[model samples]
Target: MGRSPCCCHDAGVKKGPWTEEEDKALVEHIQKRGGHVGSWRGLPKAAGLNRCGKSCRLRWTNYLRPDIKRGNFSDDEERLIIALHAGLGNKWATIATHLEGRTDNEIKNYWNTHIRKKLLRMGVDPVTHQQLPPDHHLDGASASLLPEALLWAAAAARLGGLDTGALRQAQLLQHLLHTIGSNNDATNLIANLAAANSVLNSSSRIVPSHLLQDQMNMLSGTNYLQPGYLCNTTSNFTEQDVVQQQLIKDMSPGTSTFEAAGPADQHCNTTAAFAARDVAPAVDMLPVQEFAGLMEPMELQLPNLCSLESDSFWKDLLEDGYRL
Candidate 1:
């Protein structure tokens, strides 16, 4: 049950949270008067409010003000507040002048309740807006307990209830995006990992040689070879298909890392194409089948990562700054 309201005291002044009636009286008085500035002292008496001049001023300036913004702070607003706070050093009233419709008290309360805790969790000194010393920040926490990209992945994983393996992959994917920085090749690589869940789900599906090639390309396209398109094939299972099957069969996660010669094509004698590219740093170096056809990015069936009642699940997550 709710606690009894802190009604008007012996002095006839109300305390605690202001009520609807009080707020209305304060707002109406300010609207009817030219405005409440130096007039704050007289506002309570004229407006039929039992609040003190200070209370009336605070109510009009901080809470009942017509221009005050309400609701959760936006990301831009939060960033701006942080930036302003860094320079102003707890001069919340000064900070209030810069932020549209936000009062000094509200900003101060938000800083105490929310942003300060988040910064501490991330090992940042909220007061200085700088990375805290390793010895001081949250006891044993690192200089940066939460790097932005990794933090985003971790947050998404925890909130979405992703398994440990998937969470690892998400972190790995974020790192790859930063490291590789290639166009279609890098994109295909990530799509491959995202699609791995599907392949893993259907372990008994008897994956086709071509499909295995797709996965291999996804896993390590540059270091490992990808099957080129079949040209003028004679057998139901072409030479390209047979070779790929044998390659997949021979290479497994247990296979030791080793470099292989490039292609054996008519253009550069297939085996003469550049084998010099660095092998992908995947721990499991599954060797790819070296094909004679032109090396092209395999068409992959990218999985629908997540689906929700509304727009695509991934799309919604991204829009919500889950990518942050």
Candidate 2:
């Protein structure tokens, strides 16, 4: 006899965009329960909602949660998202952590609807987040480069849990990839980065923080390093250094691993290696002038929230996709 299906769903459970009442019920229940639900599958029954557990979880995580920040992409945020995506690809959940109050779904949507299109218009491949050399054509090897879904899975498994410092450096490395392709302005930046990377990788011995800082002093002027200061080194490796060292050790043979290049030519090697994989470092062809424009903080999009006098208006606006 044929085996029974491994899973089943109840036909009685309602499925649709959550109604305001349902949203209220779920939020109220969670709040009353001290914001902890032991089992999502059991929560709907407890809250008297006729929705599936997965649906409830998704609705709360993606929308109804009080802490989720909703809005259009800020210019700085847009740039940071690109930098993160350039190195990390489409790991939206992982990327979401870097942006406080933003949800993975929101980030994913903005990237698909806005950033990806911009990159494409600029001749950058959305999947690899790399700018194609002019008139360049993809060959068999480049054409078959891994998809973002697969890349995300591999990265998730490899990363286990992320180290923010490591992630930041990886993003910077990608920025370096594309920046190197631009005009002469990046020459000094490249030189400084090469020197800094060498100091970081030179040995297990304690690297004087000043040496790395002096090498990357030019980086201070760039958008990537502008708002943030590099962490002062204690007597040991930050998580970033450990990850970098391991990355250098385990990447495929002759794969342009960071360790393979000497400081004299590290910049060239770093860019060319990942470029071959179609995920060359850096944001999409974002040149110096464009960088200057993005540096100015642009106005953020806010919800058209109505007066609090009509409490129901808020729900109506949210349902209409205007008020949230």
Local distance difference test scores for all models:
0.44, 0.47
How well does candidate 2 match the true structure in TM-score terms? Answer: 0.50
Candidate 1 residue lDDT tens string, 180-218: 221123334444333432333334222234544554454
Cα misplacement distance, residue 149 of candidate 1 (Å): 26
Cα RMSD (angstroms) for every candidate in the order listed: 20.9, 17.7
* TM-score for all models, in order of appearance: 0.40, 0.50
Q: Which stretches of candidate 2 lie over 4 Å from their true place?
A: 1-8, 133-137, 143-193, 198-324
Model 2 residue-pair collision total? 2
Regions more than 4 Å wrong, model 1 = 1-10, 36-38, 137-324
Clashes per candidate, residues 3 or more apart or on different chains: 7, 2
Q: Which candidate is the best by TM-score?
A: 2
Report how far residue 285 has shifted in candidate 1, in Å: 36
Deviation in angstroms for 162 in model 1? Answer: 52
Model 1 error, position 83 (Å): 1.0
